[model samples]
Target: MFSIVGGHPALDLANTVAPRPPGAVEEEYLPDPEALVRWARLAGVIEADEPAEPSAAALADVLALRALIDPVLAGQQLDVLLRRWAAAIERSRLIPGPHGSATLHLGTDPALVIGDRLANALIDLVRNADLSRLRTCPLADGGCGWLFLDRSRNNSRRWCSMDDCGTHAKSRRLTERRRSRR
Candidate 1:
């Protein structure tokens, strides 16, 4: 199952591929076409009414885009990803929403629809997000290298969820301390 805690779709998408400790291959959630559609749905990129099937080409495109996203979140070069994202933005159009604001819509093609929404999220990240607050979950538990935005007022949020990784880490630290005293 997918964990949708990244606060932003772009961050969530980047987290589909997680970091592993040394000597381990990175964990990948979007392994095949079906998994890709599942993640898109979970990320709210594809709606229930939308076509979410994935093809060979679409899966390749999604993985490639994720590759570009990972380094950007890590504070690396943006030129390559930016250019690709700009082209994707061109393929979408902003129209009046049912509400007073505007919403972006892509073409009817499923691949373009998914890719464009992802591109829009990435573009929004570059333009609107505070890079300082975007960071990996700080749990020392090696398996979960997920990224999230520290939307806290102090920008000090560390774990993906205090109920999950935070509790595990705290319990682990407590056990270690007790053992050392023994």
Candidate 2:
């Protein structure tokens, strides 16, 4: 999700319209907390303890979004975002806008840069997107972390040729189990 949403354009979008942080907070690096909350939806994870002091309304808005993305947040109303970061194996051939604004895709070569967000957007166009359209994959050359493609079967490709998440999750559990047994 970080690899997907942290692109320049998304960062710009988050920065462009997001509200300002209050007090002695550093404003340069992080944008408004609300925008950050929305962007987190792309990958369906959000962080906690932003530098800003958001209004009760802002906090509520962020919570609403969190509930939409993650059912777990239904109760916690997250104060901090925590997620497992798996090593990226393959990348997508995804592309962002033709607009050359302050987005991450701005400097990327027109021939390059494609991924899941585009897939989500494209799938959004069909009115009723089949859940299959949401599937994202990755390349083999250690290029992208995840990718998405346009296909009718959507079975067009596997999400991860290397199965990074599965392998990592298994490894993590194995280590934990070994320690527990010991």
TM-score of each: 0.82, 0.24
What TM-score does candidate 1 reach?
0.82
Specify the poorest-scoring 10-residue window by lDDT in model 1: 17-26
Cα lDDT tens digits for candidate 2, 23-141: 12223332455454445443333224222333445444433332222222123422322210010112223355567533322112111112123222222323353433433333232
Candidate achieving the largest lDDT = 1
CA lDDT scores, all candidates in order: 0.75, 0.32
| Candidate 2 lowest-lDDT run of ten | 80-89
In candidate 1, the residue pairs with backbone N, CA or C atoms under 3 Å apart (3 or more residues apart, or in different chains) clash, namely: none
